[model samples]
Target chain A: MVAGRAGGEVMVRSPGRFTEISQDECLELMATTTVGWLAFVDAEGQQLLPVNFVLHGQDVYFRTMSGSAISSLADGHDDVAFAVDHHDDIYQKGWDVMARGTTARVDDPDLVAQVAAGARPRPWAPGERDVLIVLRPSVISGRRVRRQ
Target chain B: MVAGRAGGEVMVRSPGRFTEISQDECLELMATTTVGWLAFVDAEGQQLLPVNFVLHGQDVYFRTMSGSAISSLADGHDDVAFAVDHHDDIYQKGWDVMARGTTARVDDPDLVAQVAAGARPRPWAPGERDVLIVLRPSVISGRRVRRQ
Candidate 1:
């Protein structure tokens, strides 16, 4: 096992190296992290695009342009994968949390009104992102490599 | 446009919010960044898993454990999406680079010998990463959000 400085994180390693994070930790990280990648299928192949998301309970919500690639592909599809990971490459440590779920457009006026009244994920990209999609995660998995 | 601090990186924003990066810059960033998420399709649907990768010209290469999901998926497939993006959530700024390509096991003994002598992406995960997979990118696209 090696020890070193990575960014501001003090990293220590154990012989085993990687640990599986708990469900609670996975949900906590998902709520706190602002950026993640959303993977969906496209004509050419599997497409993964970065998105800014907000956690509402156990569901993930994000906005995209109505005609954007994500919006188009996500239409009428339920299966989606969202992944968030952080790395300290200098110290050879990191963690990845992945969630798989079904997605649907937030079209119900009542539900839209409810979300509008609460915290929302503001789009970082410029433009009017009117299409709101919500992902209800069915399974969550995580693995971490940290100094033990 | 808003400006702020995030993980010691200076952030700026533009009115339109997103900027396109050049091919050379994309390749350079790909080479320097050690961690990225690889997206592929499986029975469950689209999957995005993080992997440590090294850039070899236009191709991206990584090693995974023999029984790992990545190794199993890349066994006989070509279409895969590898994405690397960075963000300063404090300032609501970031960029994403995506590459679409095919993956194949690097079984050529002579080529493996050549790569062994050069800079390789050391896996951060614990395990004997004997299965070497290489992704030959066919399409590359990038977008960044920066202050004007």
Candidate 2:
């Protein structure tokens, strides 16, 4: 069991058959994946959506329609989380990587041009997704589930 | 474009090549999947974790080891969100279901016994996960991404 305190709140983690992966491994995993889930809070409440993402350095980037739910992430409501995981149901093995951070709109012409020119994320859902949002993670962590 | 007010905040959704699925369809899709991601806020910040869940009526239930990150959901930090999605990279088609709600611990012996005896969710990770947490969603929504 692991016990700690976060912002005066007690946090405990019970024993489980899983091991934490290093930050390097987490970044590698994030780089290899093209899709991930983005979680954020809106006026209604919390929302989670799957988005195609690309890793540029340590920041995660994805494109969205100008007024879509995800595009709202760049409107000053920056607290957000992103997660990527691969699970094999038959073998019951998988790994998960999660990053928590703030988001901002990628509006710099030079930076946007560079991102659009090199290894840019392609949205699966069609239509013009011209707005780019970048999530600069403050913390990144991961865990790998062990075989039973 | 779709524009509306959410809690006095302007919410906009630009044109996208995706269609919203009905509530019934969302419920059905959720019932078919055993694994979903749960998003919540803790002292550290926003967190997202994959969990194996079972649908009970309109509620979702999952087990966690005591003191685990998920078990903390029942500790009065009830504002949470759950999401399940299936994506086909080759086909470029998929669907997503999201539920936003509150969580409560299942302590009733009879209900616990019944859940354990029924279509209870079996965690892929090895552990004695005895604590059951139920998410009662106040809103559920979904969308289907069309093939490009």
Candidate 3:
């Protein structure tokens, strides 16, 4: 029984007869995804907000400004929340993964270029082309809800 | 020009007109919708995951367990991420919200009962009924990423 974090308990029993997934399975799930959301606290103390994101490998990435949520992180405050999930109303089944970690504005020119080079500018919003931020996971976990 | 997190000297300008949304506007956006994603970091320090979520008023609400992503937050961790966004896939216009805050499990009988009363447990892979988690955003902000 894994000790839970906040208000409840988490029970991850061994999947005996069930199809249990390996780390490879987890990686496989993240590969095809393109977008995600970042949870950041605003400078003023209100829950910052979730923003559309671009998924790249195990790294969650995005571009934003200093006046908003992205800025709060870049200003040297790295406490942040990042999440990714998929739910199909038609299929009625889905999976969710959440990450808590310190986010930093990538400064290394090589790393910045590498991430920026491969990234497809998120077509939805503006300012996606300028600054970039990455959330490195300190603790990552997931839950799958399925109905038979 | 707002400084980039990467120090790229990004302008951090709005997409103009419709792209600017305040924190209150974001709450309205969340209310207009039912499903969003919650992200948290687990024990493994991986970019954990995303789960489809339901926003309950000011706080973001979802059900989770010990081994799941929400479980980490329920464990009483301060770092948590919850987000909600919607976009037209073809039209490429919409808003995205990112929230970062500390997490706590709901023990409030009233809140728990309210969540149980209103939350219809849709199994993503089963086993959500046993756990309850809610994210109270400390900093809530969002962007309307509509093209001008």
The top-ranked prediction according to lDDT is: 2
Writing each residue's lDDT as its tens digit, candidate 2 over A1-148 gives 2333333222223333788999999999888767799988787567788988878888987877787889888775557999998877677678999998889887776566555554433555666556777899989999998456
- Score chain B of candidate 3 by TM-score: 0.74
lDDT (10s digit) by residue, model 1, range B33-74? 778899888665677888877787788877676777898755
Question: What DockQ values do the models have?
Answer: 0.22, 0.24, 0.25
Give a tens-digit lDDT track for model 3, residues A64-87. 655654656765545566655565
Worst 10 residues of 1 chain A by lDDT: A5-14
Strongest candidate by DockQ: 3
Q: Rank the candidates by TM-score, best first.
A: 1, 2, 3
Q: Mark the regions of model 2 whose C-alpha exceeds 4 Å error after superposition.
A: A1-16, A119-121, B1-16, B119-121
Give the chain B TM-score for each candidate: 0.80, 0.84, 0.74
lDDT of 1 by residue, A26-124 (tens): 988777677889988766458788887777777777766667887763475667899898776566677889998888777766555555445444456
For residue B116, what is the lDDT in candidate 2?
A: 55
Native-contact recovery for every candidate?
A: 0.31, 0.31, 0.24
Score chain A of model 2 by TM-score against the reference chain A: 0.83
What are the lDDT figures for the candidates, one per model? 0.71, 0.76, 0.57
**Candidate 3: CAPRI quality band:** acceptable
